[model samples]
Target: MTTLQPDILIAGAGIAGATVAAGLRGRGYSVVHLEASTQPLDTARGDHLGPRVVETLANWDILDAFFAAGAEKRLGAKWLTPEGVVIMHSSIDDLPLPYPFYVVLNHDLIATTALDLAVTAADYDYTLFRPVAARDISTGADAHGGVTEVSITTPEGEAVTIKPRMTIACDGRSSKIRAACDFQIAHTYDYEKPFVVLFGPRGELQDPRNEINSYMSLNGGVSRIPRIGGQWKIGLAIDKQDIGRWKSTTSDERKALLAERAPALGEMETEVAGFYPVIRRESDYWTKGTTVLLGDACHTIHPARGQGMNFGIRCAARLFDFLPDPTEMSDAALVAQRLADYEAAVKPLTDAQLSENHERGLHMDCTGPERMQAEIPTLRAVAADPDANFRYRMTMAGYPDRLDPK
Candidate 1:
């Protein structure tokens, strides 16, 4: 068995983990990241990155590369009727932030970009173990719950033991580190309808300003998210009872159903990406001793608003703010204190986000005329009112407090 020691050990090389690794580079810290998958991650994951997520990328020196890689800009979000009548719209063109617009790109591409830079761009010592799985973990003897060591087997069948002062779990919903640490789930909210994701040529929808148009009606909701190169990612909410038929239907049949449900879209050549039944969940705590949970490992929410990746990236940046320098890794008590501080600062905000997203999911799941009579009017009102529209836009841009006079 080979033994290695690093200042930080991050499990999983997805967006959250890669962001943490990239942000930590040039900070005089040694990092070891492990990825169980041999190839790249699924490309069909969340693609929208909010303004705040772009800001985080800029802070980490990743914005230039992201855009250069064909990431597109979305002005804002809009709500419309199935027949293409606009109900409400929120544009970030006037936002005071540096990067005022949202970014649309493949999730795996961005994560891989960050990981590529994390490994090669900086002079810091960073190691990535691909096709390797964490087989065992041992926590400290104290009650604070820090991990002492982790055991893994490399692709070459070599046994390795990693010892780090701090551990970060970004291994997605079924995270092994989180389970091993015994983080209790505090709450969960499941959406009533599953979303069918389809991607293909943009057809007549050629405007970037209309990229995030959401159509809600008595039938259901269908959203058109534009991608770079004149492509569209369609999100259609499927009834639970009709899901079996949807599964059995051909590609053309699914396209027809989408047109029937959302007439504004008409018929377009597209491919079904995947089906997602979203569930919002949050853990009782995000930190224990020197171990911290980031991204889907700690919390998950509905993807309708495209905040999951943004929240994860923001969490990593916030964590970087609390972490100590390489020289301070030996101070176990101090590290533990900092970990506690991180949890205390971030958990409440994350919990609040979970609640808000759960509410939005419930709102999006509505069918029939009740949504039009009740909720549609309120949304239109919010859009029509200047101050209300500004506040709503700011919040959706991930800067809810920017409106403060202070």
Candidate 2:
């Protein structure tokens, strides 16, 4: 029905995409963001933002909006034993960062709020193609060896070609653009089990120690995150094979299952909200000429630590850091260099985070009937050791293992 071209094209309007679009608009760059789903993809996922993202939000001048979106302050991480005894907790309260608190806000809120802020930004030039998807891509062989144009299909069965200086694929793990384009997945670590999250009201679940809690027993573990509306998010680790069986669980069956595994989580009267598979995958090269991968597109990791979305936001920040001056436009070389510079600064950090997450998933993803009970004492000791505790708090506080931009 209509045609539009912009300086930058973003696929997927999730937190990462919206952050990139919003941050760039503040830098006076025109952007186009595409969303495949007709409505916002609201899932009970990525609700925790560590201090890094909290600081990043403030830097982008959207911290107020993020807080206004109704977020519960996550004081720190707490790991509980089967009997609900606190085994370990490293309070991030003392972290020397600008934001020392982790805010638990739902994806829909932060993401939609991000888009809203982008819309009201000074001189915002953005176009949204909802319920549309990129079906194919055309690439050029010259300066940026980047995508020339992407053919997207509208909901009404119309195809349109839009060209952009840079196309950012922020479409999560199953990025259609990354699939259609020439990006290569250099490394992939797929879990035998995916992280499954079930949501229900904060009914009668005993909350005497009502903190963001990880309830682990000998019979697999579940994490309970308190949401804005007295709702609790139940996170489960389901093996890859049992994915369908778990997804097909009935409403009552879900409650029963929740009561069985995470009895402390009260009852889950509602059906499963979402089941997300955990995988750590990164492209060999995030930027190829004019096209660059952002967010989960570049590094899709397990929810071991709460750094997935934070990492994606960092990517957007680095892109904001390296965006070329508007007047430097037609110099394909300049655009290519900017793209490459962002990637150069971001990819190494992503690699380290991805590797670190892989290890965390292996140790923390103990879903067997027998909990990692035996390792609890050792872990408790580590939590008690002054140096080890500092290190743990530092890492758990969202400190980057490597801060080098190279």
Candidate 3:
């Protein structure tokens, strides 16, 4: 088959992959992006990015594009109890910094914008290969240092050998590149519940005007996220065993359950309903030879706080910071340094976020007398204390200034 050589080879053209590619291209690095899917990714997915994620996008000079692409400015987030008691409210405008707190945009639009920028930039030198899959990766020591040979299957199903300076896997959780490299994935499984995400029109929600609203109920927890085009995305967590029953139930039963859990939703029409088991996994090592993992391939957090895509965006920014100029150093050295810096910069943030989100999920799912007696009082106290609420808001905003490299 045909053989090609590029400065860098990136697998997966999702948000993480596209963002990294755009950053590297700006720095004059040649790249080849391989995307397995031919169609554009679903825009509805990953529609929100926190302030930190916004800052990262700004650094790449693409924030304006994102905003122009119909990204809605999010004011803040609100937390509520089963009885609709407002427990906590955090606003982005309240932050000491001037950065936008959050932006809600179609993920597909963002990816497409970044890709378009990368492909059309004045110094565009990267090639995007669609319908391409990386099947295997072989690493070897070279006179300079280390080299990785990647075997990619093209749309025609022919295996083509591509020897890039390095391979960055921005693939999602089930990354074939990570599997081929045999990287150890450290994961914590949360079987507490399965969640069904419903996307559709938002009828009427006054309390959560331009903000996300989360409700903790005795039966379950639900999060309502506002999206572009006046659509709202709602996630309802249910017992794992109840998933089958929920799926088997008639459409009317499901609709009734939605009404029962989130009465505020009213009569909004649902366009789609997707369900999946909740899981969190992180790679022990982000690098192996010339291959490195980024985004969900490296770590995955619970969707409770809607931080999965945000975390991936941060990882992409870290990788952008560590990327080396191909002309300045050997491919092997650049790859190693980039991988080390990426792991060093991202692991701690992701680890802490994973832990914090797990605890938050547990707290939100709490029920029974123990919750009413212990958790509710503690939450009320935390909510009542201005200092505590301020600190909580800062933490949720990602403490951007504190992300200094250690």
CA lDDT, every model vs. true structure? 0.82, 0.74, 0.72
Error of 3 at 344 (Å): 3.1
Separate clash counts for every candidate: 0, 3, 0
- lDDT (Cα, tens digit) per residue for candidate 3, span 1-406: 8787777888898888888777775676778888888788865556788877788788888889887887778889777774567876777776675584788887788788888878788876898878786666666664123236777777767778888777888888888877877777776666476667777655444433468887655545677788876667887767777777876766566666766655665455664467867777777788776677877787766676778778777777767667677685355765677777777777786687778887766754553345445655666787798777666676677674453323
> Per-residue lDDT tens digits of candidate 2, residues 1-406?
4555677889988889887767675565678788887677575778777777777888888788877877667767678875568888877776666687877788888888888887777677877778777667777864367767878777667777788777888988888777766788888887767777777665534443235777766677778776665777777787678778888888777766666666655444665778776777877888888788888887788887778888888667777778788667556778888888887777786687678788878765667754466666767997788777777776665665622223
Candidate 1 differs from the real structure by a C-alpha RMSD in angstroms, to one decimal, of 1.8
Quality of model 1 by C-alpha lDDT = 0.82
| Reference-based TM-score of each model | 0.95, 0.87, 0.88
* Cα misplacement distance, residue 145 of candidate 2 (Å): 1.3
List model 1 lDDT by residue over 1-406, tens digit each. 9999888999988889888888887889888999888777777778888898889889988888888887878898788988888899788877888898888878788888888889896488999999776659888745268688999888788889998888898988878888888888888778898887888765546695745888876677778888767778888767888777877777678667878767767676777778888887777889888899899988887886788888899888888899987899877778889989988887787677778888778877876667656877898899889888888888888887587623
Using lDDT as the measure, which candidate wins? 1
Superposed on all Cα atoms, the candidates' RMSDs to the truth, in angstroms, are 1.8, 3.6, 3.4
**Model 2 regions more than 4 Å off:** 1-5, 152-160, 202-210, 240-271, 369-375, 401-406
Q: Which residue runs of candidate 3 sit more than 4 Å off their true CA positions? A: 143-147, 156-159, 202-209, 248-252, 266-272, 329-331, 361-375, 400-406
